[model samples]
Target chain A: ELKVEQNPLFLSMQEGKNYTIYCNYSTTSDRLYWYRQDPGKSLESLFVLLSNGAVKQEGRLMASLDTKARLSTLHITAAVHDLSATYFCAVEMGTASKLTFGTGTRLQVTL
Target chain B: DAGVTQSPTHLIKTRGQQVTLRCSPKSGHDTVSWYQQALGQGPQFIFQYYEEEERQRGNFPDRFSGHQFPNYSSELNVNALLLGDSALYLCASSLYGDYGYTFGSGTRLTVV
Candidate 1:
């Protein structure tokens, strides 16, 4: 069984600050993904990390994976209020398989 | 192109009743997967369908069932619903063997 864990389940940060969310899995999996969801809304895809040492960034958010360590990280640079939302990390053992999702990190960026 | 779409956005059902939800996959995708998301929690995989057959399933019980049409549309049926079953049901679609997915807004089922 693959268990995914995320740190800082709740976050409150000032705008323009930097932070990072960590995702660790209990099993081996090369494919990892990041998703963001607003209150009462569907999830929005953020990044797909396919291999070890893979890193992807969009705007102020950056995500990276380390298959060897079975860990992934989502980094936020200069956070803004619009970036506030619950973020999740999912890991898959195969290309075509179900994903095990993390507990989720709720972020609140205030002015 | 249009994204994945789910019908009956919100539903309220009594315990022990049965409920069905529907989903339409995105264009050019042939696989559909269903997930259950509770309040303040990440989505949990329920099952996946491909070639009109169930390809994978999670830890859900038999009371949870599904079907996929040739057109790749899907339906999720739950029997003997319990209040614990109440949650947002999300449908995700992707090409066969691909990792990228397009997710529907989801159907919020409330079991009273």
Candidate 2:
């Protein structure tokens, strides 16, 4: 069974601070995805890291993947109040279309 | 162009009853995937449909079944629903062999 674990399941940060949410998988995967979900809303795709050492950034969010280490990271740079939401990292096992997701990290950015 | 869309934004069902949910994938997407997400948890893969057939399924039981239409739309049927079945049913669409997916708003199913 492929299992995904995320660290700091709950995060409360001040504005202008930085934090990184880590996702670790038990098995090898070829793709990793980051999504953001607000209360009562659907998920919004944040980043898709397809290869080892692949990094993608948009605005204040950046995501990186390391296949060898079976890990991915979503880094929040200079977080702002509007960045508060639940962040999830999902891993796609080799040749499988399904994704195994981590427990998710709820980020509460305070002003 | 619209992203993935699901029907019956919210539903309420009784235990032992059956329910059907619908989904329309994003334009030009040939694959549709279903996921179950409980409150405060990450979504769990239920199944995936492609080419009007069930190509992949997750750890769900037989009570959870689905069908894909020729137009790439899909329906998810749950029979003999249990209280545990109460959750948000999310439909995601992606092109075959693609690495990214677009998700729908999801149907909030409440089983009484």
Candidate 3:
């Protein structure tokens, strides 16, 4: 069984501060993805890291993957209230593309 | 372009009842996947359908089944529902061999 775990399941930070959410998986996989979900909403894709050293950035968010370590990270830079949401990291299981997701990091950014 | 589409944004069912959820893949997408997200938790894969066949499945039990149409649309059926079955069911679509996926807003199922 593949297990994905995220750290700091709940985070509360002030605006302009920075934080990083860590995702560690139990198995080996080359494809990792970041997704953000607001309360009661669907997930929004943030990044797709396909290689061991792959990194992707979008506005105030950035994500990186390290396949050898079976770990991935999502970094929030200078957080804003709008950035408050639950973030999840998913690893593609096999050729079928099944995703095993982390528990998720709920970020609450306040002013 | 429209992303993944799921019908009946919300539903309420009683224990032991059966429920069916539907999904339509996005344009040019040939594969459909279903996931179940419990409150305060991440989505868990249920299964994936491609070419009108179930190609992959997760740990869900046999009570959970699905069907895919030739047009790439899909349906998820959960029989003898339990209270724990209540959750937001999500549908995702992607092209075959493509790692990218587009998720649907999800159907919130509340089992009483």
Candidate 4:
């Protein structure tokens, strides 16, 4: 079975601080996805990393994938209260259309 | 354009009852996938549908069944509901063989 694990399941940070969330998978996968979910809301796509060493950045968030290490990272820069949410990483194996998601990291940014 | 859309934002059902949930994929998407997300956990894949047929399924039991229409919309039906079945049912849409997908808000199903 493919297992995806995330580090720092819960994070409480002050505004302007920086943090990185890690996602490690047990098996090989073709793609990795980063998503953010607010309480009582559905997931919103953050980044899609398609290859080893692929990195994508949007505003205050950046994501990187290391397929050889079977790992991915979501780095938050200059965090703000609005950036507080539960972040998840998903792995897609081979040609399968389904995704296996990580346990998620709940981030709280206090002013 | 709208992303994926699911009906009955929330539902409440009792044990042994059956329930059906609906989904409409994003425009131009031909594949629909269903997932179950328990409280405080990530979503778990239940199945995927393409070309009006099941393309992939997860470790779920036969009680979990689904259908895809010609229009690419889909429905998920669960029989003999159990307390453990309570979770948020999410629907995702993508083009066939595509690497990315768009997800719906999900239906929050509560089992009593």
Off by over 4 Å in 2: none
Tens digits of lDDT, candidate 1, B23-50: 9999999999999999988899999999
- DockQ-best of 3 and 4: 3
Clashing pairs in 3: none
How good is chain A of candidate 3, measured by TM-score? 0.96
Ranking by TM-score: 1, 4, 3, 2
Q: Which candidate has the highest TM-score of all?
A: 1
Q: What is the lDDT of residue A80 in candidate 1?
A: 100
What lDDT would candidate 2 get against the real structure?
A: 0.93
Cα lDDT tens digits, model 3, A1-111, are 889999999999999999999999999886888999999999999998988889889999989888888889898999999999999999886665799999999999999
Instruction: State the lDDT of candidate 2 residue by residue for A1-111, as single tens digits.
Output: 999999989999999999999999999888899999999889999998988999999999989998898989999999999999999999886553998889999999998
Least well predicted 10-residue stretch by lDDT in candidate 4 chain A: A91-100
Badly placed stretches (over 4 Å) of model 3 are none
In model 1, what lDDT does residue A71 have?
A: 87
Number of the candidate with higher lDDT, 1 or 2 = 1
For model 4, what is the alpha-carbon lDDT of residue B89? 97
For all candidates listed, what's the TM-score of chain B alone? 0.98, 0.98, 0.98, 0.99
What overall lDDT, based on C-alpha atoms, would model 4 receive against the true structure? 0.95
Which 10 successive residues of model 3 chain A have the least lDDT summed? A91-100
Comparing 2 with 3 on DockQ, the higher-scoring candidate is 3
